[model samples]
Target: MPSQEALSAQVGAVYTTSTGAPVAEPYAAQRVGLTGPLLLQDFHHIDLLAHFDRERIPERVVHAKGSGAHGVIKVTHDITDLTVASLFSKVGNEAPLTIRFSTVGGESGSADTARDPRGFAIKIKTDEGNLDWVFNNTPVFFIRDPAKFPHFIHTQKRDPQTHLKDADMFWDYLSQNPESIHQVMILFSDRGTPDGYYMHGYSGHTFKFVNKDGKFHYVQIHLRREGGAKSLDNDTAQRLAGENPDYATEQLFTEIEAGKFPTWNVFVQTMTAEQAESFRYNILDLTKVWPHKEFPLRPVGQIILNKNVQNYFAEIEQAAFSPSHLVPGIEPSADPVLQSRLFSYPDTHRHRLGVNYGQLPVNAPLAPVSNFQRDGAMAFNNQGFRPNYQSSLAPLQYKRKAYEDVKHEIWLGDANVDLSYVTELDFEQPRALYEKVFSDTDREHLIYNLSVHLGNVKSPIVKARQLSVFAAVSKDLGDRLAKAINHPSVEPLAVKPATEAIRYKLKAA
Candidate 1:
């Protein structure tokens, strides 16, 4: 292992300014004879104070609390037939990677054991470029509509006037948008508070893997912890949240530093466009999952976290990952949330990490970048001496398409949008998840967890509405939740079921 001061060029160094001008003293400011007002001529003192005042960047609006580590991803299977992504070019090919695990809807200081969906974001520095899989720990999410995301996130945060985490705000959103029920069930389950960063991961939205033959398959990415998903009981998670707020974050870094590296296996479930068209659920819906029975998980690679980051602020905090960071042969689906993220993520990075964020060491691509873009804040490399526009004298090179004549997806419909309303089918998967997927103990604990959280909600109408949503999933679950909270159930408002999408398409036919 390297020494803690390995990065330092000199064992004992003189203090320096931001631009490296040697500083004689930084402890005491240059004042008028040490008793009068400070001298404005002292550049080093002024610079130190100014930089300290603006040291921290704005926190991420979501997934604010996070832990990160460096790792390697080794391809374990030949998936060239599925996609031309260079990382999967051959079995045993290894690529350097960095992963950042975060809690959704929490501030930077929030507890690691908080009951929230974890963000499992990995950036692979491949020969082609950086391929980032910014995924979640759950197979599904709360809402499908992209426009509703801000509104949904607002509910997760504290109330505006009260400045407190409002249960009414949280439960009301879930109750109204029952599409969130599937994820709500998972969020309330043991999986919500994972034991550590090595737990399972999933791309809730469908994506595309296009092959050299111009064939494309809708894909769902998954990552299973080397041993399997490990989770904490609600009681334990809550207890640890108070006792050790940074439990998971601290553990991951400590384990890596101690050489007890954790690992996870990457897998994907692929469905052809035809299969997706005939599938039970809308393939683009983020709130549903493709049944593993029909589309089984195919092993792709292994991700091993073997190193801890040296500087949390420089490497981890400044690091950025986005689903839009595709190398090649991969593309975003028509999933509304994912399509929206392709824009929103880079937008946030610009605001948070500046327009030249990609030039940051942690976010920069390993592959050579040749673009007309130049000049921005923190412009580390301005493509020196190159024309910013196309010129015959120095024509920019372009890569040929690996595949041609592929069927391009064309999205067509009315400009007006409606929320993908709830249906009997909408509740079907969560019902199976509650009955078949979960063990009896898991079900009991889930009920208890939901009961405790929902019980805190002071509004009777909100509780009643949530119970109705649960009832739609299963009367047993609804009854169990109501009994646990000692509350009466109310009927949920009827919305068009998922079959409605098919019905509308059929009627158009």
Candidate 2:
């Protein structure tokens, strides 16, 4: 660890005029006479206010509140045949990593214990490049369509007129979009509010793993904490939210400082092109998961966070992650949501940070960066005098790797255009998830949780719509939820609202 004196030297601090002359006194401003108007020529005063006015950059639009740590990712199992990614090519290989955990919809000052999905993002500084796994604590998401993401996130945010969280808007969106029932079920369970940063799991939404020969396979990454997942009940979480809003962040930092590092086992489930073609569910759907029985987890590596960031603003706030930052062996899946994020993540960084944000030490790649692109805001590490453009005089050399080993599969349907549509196949996995995967105790908690949140929604029409979607998942679940909320069965509600009647009957049947 660098000492305070060393760090201060690295980042200088002195009250000086713009011309570099040190000010004799910083507290008092220049005045023509005692209690007279201040002189306009006081450069020190003018510069102090000018710098203070523009000190802060734009806050993150989402995941604004977060905690980060420095660590090392150690490869435990060799899967060189699965991925040509240098990080996983050799066993015992260690790469410097920085991780950020955050609440999805909260502002920079919001409570950390809110009942929201946590962002588990890791940036690994590998020799090939910086590979970032921008994931969430939950394995599945609410909707698979990238178009609906903005709508779903809107419901989680404040109301347009009231500027406060509105339960009606939330239930209304969920009820209309029946596909969200699966994620809703999981969120209402105890897993929603994790006990701390160390007691949760991380999952890569779309698979992107490849082999040494550039052969790629569809894969999902999982990180299970050594201590196992733990959670706080609604009462406890609410109490702590009021008492200590930064509980999770403080706990994570203090534990690392005390030498009690948290570790997670990394695993990946792989699927060949042929396997994905005939899979029961759409393998690319973000809302569904491949059955573990069919594709077992293959051990890949381990991540242990031992170092806490000394400066949150420099390290954590400026850290960036993007799905587009993939290396040679690893590639992206055809998932639309993943495809959209490939553009969105970096664009947001450009808005929040700057075009040259990657040049920051926290986000810079470990390997040498040589490219034709140059000269943007904060051009700190510009390659001096290097050819900024490829030309005959430069005599650029290119190395082409053979793509013969790359897996190829046939596509039967339309290859282009927006491929977003709902089918009966979409409900199959959610149905199985609700009926088979959850235990009796789990089901009770789900019902109780749903009732508490849904009970607060003012619109009876929205409540009925949500109940109908729940009914589609399971007749018993819908019936029980209506009973708990003091509403009749779907048959009665169907008669009152004829338009909604058709939608409900289709789901109820």
- Backbone clashes for every candidate come to 1, 6
lDDT of predicted model 1: 0.86
| lDDT by residue for model 2 (16-116), tens | 67788987798888898999998999878888898999989888888889999999999999888777777787899999999999988888998888888
| CA RMSD, predictions in order | 2.2, 4.9
Winning candidate number (lDDT): 1
Q: How close is candidate 1 to the true structure, as a TM-score?
A: 0.95
Clashing pairs in 2: 82-210, 82-211, 83-210, 83-211, 84-211, 207-219
Which lDDT values do the candidates have, in the order given? Answer: 0.86, 0.79
Error at 494, model 2, angstroms: 12
Model 1 RMSD vs true structure: 2.2
